[model samples]
Every structure is written in C-alpha cells, then in structure tokens.
Target: MPSPCSSPRLLRHGPIFFAAFLSFFVSLGTLPAKAVEPDEVLQDQALEARARHISEGLRCLVCQNQSIEDSAAPLAKDLRLLVRERLKAGDTDQQIEDFVVARYGEFVLLKPRFEPHTLILWFATPVVFIVALLIVVLAYRRRSAAAQLPPLSKAEERRLKRLLEDR
Candidate 1:
C-alpha cells in the first residue's frame, strides 16, 4: 500500500489547497491594520470621522514611514487620542494640525508643506531623473557615433581585404 503523502487523491487536491492558502495570506496583506482601541473612539460620529482623517495625514514618529492611522506604536495611539481630544474641543482640522505641528515639528506630518525649506524634497527626484535621462541620451549618442566607424578609408578597406584573404 502507498503512503498517504503519495496518494492519488492528495496529489489531485494539493495545488487547490496550496492556492487557497496563498490567497488567504494575500488577502490578509490587503487589509488595513487599524490600531484604534474602543476607548479612543469618540462618542460623536462626525468628530470621530474628522479625527480619523486627521490621523491619516499625521506620521507615526516611531514608524516614520507609516501614518498614525495605520501604525500600532504607542506614540501613534497618543497622536490618535490627541486628535480626538482636539476635535472634542471644537478645533478645526487646520487648528488641530497646526497644534500637532507646533508640538511635534513638521516631521510629524505625512505630507510636508511645500516651502523654501522643503523645495529640495519636492524637486530633487525630477531634477535627478532629468540629469539621468540626459546622461543616458548622451551615452547612447556617443555609442551610435562610435559604432558608425566614419566610412573606413579606401586604404583601410584594402588592408582588411588582404587580412581576410590571408586567413
């Protein structure tokens, strides 16, 4: 008798089982990890929505790449609570944001405002891309020019013919 691992039934169903397992993990990755706890949520729905919006635009200081809404860090939780508190205090979104910026510096904002200080951050990628594109064009032009061998002189053509005959 064959072992269970080598059974024809298992073999037939293995790929289907593997695909379902893979898809389950893939779906999990697509789901957002909301870190807001029950106590942090505001009683007012509109205020809660506004707070969530503000939180999404604020960066998590501990997880610099993730927004506060998506981050699970303690600091992110604090920021979320702060946003809700400000909302309860009847602060406009701008005021709440300004308050946070004043407290945490501009680094806490997920999207930094375009200003003289951040000009390089906004323009560097395009400037570097333009420079790289120019370099590639220049290199390609040089390679094309180099490959064209200026119509090898008559004497050089004769020398090539002689070498080929000798070979």
Candidate 2:
C-alpha cells in the first residue's frame, strides 16, 4: 500500500478539496440582497440595463470616481434621466453617449473617442518612446565607438615610460 504522504493521493484529492473550499467561500457573496427600489430603476428592464451599462462607462461630473448611475448628485441624476429619456426616444447607445460627450465634452465618456484631438493621445506615447529609444541607441553607439579608439602614439607611450621610470 502507498504511504500516507504519497503524491498520487494528494494530487487527486488536492484539487477537489480546494475547489469545494473555494465554492463554499465564494458562495458567501452570491446570495441575493434587497430588491431594487421602484423609484431607482425605470419600468423597462432592458432599457434600464442598457442605460446602466452606458452610465457605468460615463463619469459623474459631481462625484468622486462614481459613475452617473451610482452618483446621487443632481448632475449625475440628471445625466441618468437624460440617458433613459434618450433611450426611450430610440437613440442608440453610441448616439446617446455621443450626445452626452458633445454636451459635456470628452470628460463625460470614460473612454474618449479616437478622433483628431484624441489621436495624439493614441500616437504620441509610442512616438515619444521610439524617439527616446533611438536617442539611447545613438548615445550607446557613440559611447562604444569612443571606447574603441586607436592606441596612443609611440612617442606618447615612450614619454609616459620615461616619466614613470624617471620618477
């Protein structure tokens, strides 16, 4: 019979034990809590879900790091209602987001559009990195070339020898 400390038994039982433990631990947060308030969400579940998805991607103008949907500030509430109203009016999610961005500037959209002004936001970092790499490469090459200079003249070597011997 295999010893108690054998590898096969441990390997076979380890993952099963760990998985059960994780399932038990993770289930602590999986239970449903209090239901959503009637005043909180609009009548339409799908529309409200869409609005939430969009709003979660939008920054609240008055709140610290809170999305418009989560923020209770007047501006956030206004923006949330505006999103729902725009959805009811049949505006696509992108269209509603674009409307909000146009009104509030790119700061409203968590991920700004990659247009002319924001193109630099996309390209400038890479360009700077490439230029810096090129400069480093040139500097390294220059340093290496400087280190590879020809030996000193025979006269200079003789003078050094004489100075050292005389001293």
Candidate 3:
C-alpha cells in the first residue's frame, strides 16, 4: 500500500507547493529598499557614492540601531543631507566621518571606533567564554572524581543487604 505522503491527491498539488516555496524564497532574497528620497541624491556620481558609503556607517540617532542609509527617521535624513553637503565641500571620507563623530559622539557610528574606553567591549566575549569553559571543566572533573569513589562502607553495605532481605 502507498503511504499517505505519496498519495495522488498530494502529488497533484506538488507543482503549486513548489511554486509557493520558490516565490517565498525569492522574495526573501531581495534586499530591503533604502529610504533615500529623489531630491536627496547627489548630482555627482563619485560624490554620491562616497556620501552613500559614509551614510551606511552612520547610526540613525532617532531610530537608535538602524544605519542612516536604511533608516526612515528624520535624524537619518538630516544626517544623509549633512553627508552630501560635506561631500560637496570636497571632504575626504575620514574627514566627513570625523565631523559626524565630533558632533554626535561615537554612539552615532554604526561601527564604533576602537579606543581605551571600548577595550572592555572588544575583549568581554572571550573572557566570558574562557571563564565558562574553566567552570565546565572543573564541574566535569569534580563529577568524574565523585563517580570514581568506592561504592559504600562495609557497614552501609550490610545495612542495605539487611533492608533488601526484609523487603
């Protein structure tokens, strides 16, 4: 007998199932649309590209976590405009980034700069992992040591035997 999973009814709908699955994955593969407006775009391709590249690294202050390139926030729009104005003035990418950082502090950067204050942020995960590994190793060793001890004292063994006989 054929299994229910291999029934003609299910097989008839196989193409529909496959089409739905393919369309779902194709939609997922598409990138999220940017929120940049038409008027906001720079006239110069090179300057626009640089502006976009810089904007991608900037955090949207209002949105908290979204990059300026992706955010719909008013602050993100302003930041995008500011990046364009800086590009128009012939600022280098480093200079533009420094200007934004000086005005907004490091929190406005999508990727924070490495500094003495951020040393803890950089090293915390490894320190935690090593500590957890040591704890796990110590626990396993203690458990193995306890498991290897002799089963019982002679008196305890005799007591257990007496209990078993009584039962």
Lowest lDDT block of 10, candidate 2: 31-40
Two-way TM-score contest, 1 vs 3, winner: 1
Per-residue accuracy of model 3 over 32-106 as CA lDDT, tens digit each? 668899999988898888888999899999987778998998889999999999889888999999999999999
List runs of model 1 lying over 4 Å from the truth: 1-24, 157-167
Pairs with backbone N, CA or C atoms under 3 Å apart (clashes), candidate 2:
none
Which residue pairs clash in candidate 3?
Answer: none
TM-score of 1: 0.77
For all predictions, the C-alpha RMSD in Å is 4.9, 6.7, 4.9
- Give model 3's TM-score versus the native structure: 0.76
TM-score of each: 0.77, 0.56, 0.76
**How would you encode candidate 1's per-residue C-alpha lDDT over 9-52 as one tens digit per residue?**
99999999999999999999988888898999998899999999
Model 3 ranges off by over 4 Å? 1-31, 160-167
Candidate 2 steric clashes: 0
Candidate achieving the largest TM-score = 1
**Candidate 1 — worst ten consecutive residues by lDDT sum?**
145-154
Error of 2 at 144 (Å): 1.9
